[model samples]
Target: MISGAHVILYSQDAEADRAFIRDVLAFPGVDAGGGWLIFKLPPAEVAVHPTDGPPQHEFFLMCDDLDTQLGEFRAQGVEVTRPVSEQRWGKLTAIRLPSGAELPLYEPLHPIAHSL
Candidate 1:
């Protein structure tokens, strides 16, 4: 039986990365106790070619208030690709991290939104 999977990101500045998720995006995270940090995410789906594909994983997060989230990211001076666009199943936006990595933030329109 599978227990769980934790997505690990390599960051040049762990504190900045943590700030981007916590202060900027306001993600709910907890101190992993020994200086490690963990951000809580909504239920997600993993794509088959995660490691072979982009630097990011396949577990796409579906945000309920994408506009609000995007705005907060903007206010924090976080670089966003553009306004959320309508994808086949959800709305999409990309945010750049201090580690020079781009992560996708999205909101689902189909099945509208079930979880966070």
Candidate 2:
């Protein structure tokens, strides 16, 4: 059965990035011996977007309030890569990870299907 999904982020400084996810983002996880951490993600949804360029995938963390979340992230020393912008589906922005990768974040304006 297709029960769940696992997403991996490749980082230059794996330990630091792991710490950021565990401590900063406060995702609950278990240490799989030798300090390997595996986190439990929140409810997730996926979309397929048509593109003309090379095939790729992207991930975003969804929120109920973008401004409040951004403020909390800023106070935690996280870098905001882009200001929030309105879209038909959501209010979107990007934040920099500890590995210097930009992660998209959004608050959906459209109906959510995660619970359905």
Candidate 3:
């Protein structure tokens, strides 16, 4: 029986990233132990795609309004590392984390599985 999934983001500055997630993104979480915070993500869905090369994993945050979300992020001083680009599947962009890692975001053009 599947309960949920836990995704990890490897960060160069884990503490700073954690704070960003907590304060900026406002993701509620529990302290695992001694300041180890485990964040709660929204409803998730998984899909398998065929790749010719080696297998790799990816993560992206989905939103309804790309422009509105980007505006909010910008207001919080979040860096938009990648500008919004139109994709076949969505309008894609990325944000820079405190650790200098970029997290992908999109407003899906195609129907999403998470709702089902």
Candidate 4:
């Protein structure tokens, strides 16, 4: 019985990133001893795809409407590192974290499994 998944994003400025997750993203998380905030993500789904190269794991935050979400993020002074590009599976974009790392964001055109 799997309970949940915990994803970690390594950052150079962890404290600033944590603040961004807390204040900007508005994720509800408890400070687990000395301000190590672990965010509570929404329902998640995973998929496996064939690859020709080396295997690697990637994470993306999904949204219902990418344009609206990007607009909201811009309003908060968040940098949109990549413009949205329509793919066969989804519309994708990237945002810059406080530590100068890029995090992918997408709105899937394919069927989603998160509700199940």
Per-residue lDDT tens digits of candidate 3, residues 1-116? 98889899999999999999999989999999999999999878887999999999999999999999999999999999998999999999999999999999999999889978
The weakest ten consecutive residues by lDDT in model 4 span 41-50
User: Model 2, 1-116: lDDT tens per residue?
Assistant: 99999998888888988998898889999998999999999899988999999989998999999999999999999999998899989999999888888889999999997878
Q: Which 10 residues in a row give candidate 1 its minimum summed lDDT?
A: 44-53
- The regions of model 3 sitting more than 4 angstroms off are none
Name the candidate that leads on lDDT.
3
lDDT: the better of candidates 1 and 4? 4
Model 4 has an lDDT value of 0.93
Candidates sorted by lDDT, best first: 3, 4, 2, 1
Best by TM-score: 3
Model 2: which residue pairs collide?
A: none
Question: Over the stretch 11-98, how does candidate 1's per-residue lDDT look in tens digits?
Answer: 7787888877787667798998985779976565554444655574343556788888778767878898666788887889888888
Instruction: Give Cα distance to truth, residue 1, candidate 1, Å.
Output: 4.9
Report the error of model 1 at residue 36, Å: 1.7
